[model samples]
Target: MFNKTPFKGTSRTSSGYSYDDDQFASKVFGEIARKDWQDYRNTFMPVHEIFKTAVMSDDLTKQQLDRIPGNIDAQFKQSQAQASAINERMGLSNLNTGRTDISKGLAQVFAENSARTHGKERKMSAIAGANISPQDARVNQ
Candidate 1:
């Protein structure tokens, strides 16, 4: 947003705008007209750029541009629906921290069961390695 401001007590230079001439300063109306001309000149480049783009765009390009707005609208709606489903499944992002407690409980149960199984296997291996028949062990006892 370019704005036109006059050279006051403290002067600011606008590009291509020269310092106020004593002669020009004496003529307030001329200075106003000069500023107006500069403002109009500044507007030219942007307008020309837009005009060039409009001229170069074909019907296909125009259709693509038109589709962008609609596509954005549809994608936003789909994403919102997806977010709702995810929130419901996860018990709401803000309210639920995680299932850490359940995971830890299951891990403890697994460890206990694994230890019992290892102990049973070790005892069975020792008994088998001894090569003692049940009757021989009973006679020894």
Candidate 2:
């Protein structure tokens, strides 16, 4: 048995048996499969991150927008109370017109806030879109 030359590469083990072609091929195929899986995961990871960012951004914007009406209402009430106190002190009961001015100011503030929020949403979307590679775009589509 010591005079016999084993096939393929010599074994590193003490058994002295060489690897058969099938065994070698099986190991290579397994390694190739593992590498392919790793590559597939790497390719999709960025796409997943981009998608997560987009979703989070939309959610954050929605939360901000939803809070706006309540905030505006609260601010308007506070301003109205202050205006009412001033009018009371001045003994001007007919000048409840302060409510109209308060409404206008609140409306202006809400409009400005909405514009800024929308602008921020657009910017975040642009950043997400810009980060997509050609490969990522294909994968996304």
Please list the Cα RMSD from the true structure of every candidate, rounded to 1 decimal place: 35.9, 9.2
Candidate 2 wrongly placed segments (more than 4 Å)? 1-51, 54-57, 98-141
lDDT of 2 at 55: 46
Q: For residues 29-73, what per-residue lDDT tens digits would candidate 1 score against the true structure?
A: 666888898988798878755543443334323344445545555
User: Residue-wise lDDT of candidate 2 within 93-122, one digit each (tens)?
Assistant: 745654676676678577658756764756
TM accuracy, model 1: 0.25
Candidate 1 residues lying further than 4 Å off, grouped into runs, are 1-57, 93-141
The residue pairs that clash in candidate 2, if any, are none
Tell me the lDDT of candidate 1. 0.51
Q: Which pairs in model 1 have colliding backbones?
A: none
Which 10 consecutive positions of candidate 1 have the poorest summed lDDT? 132-141
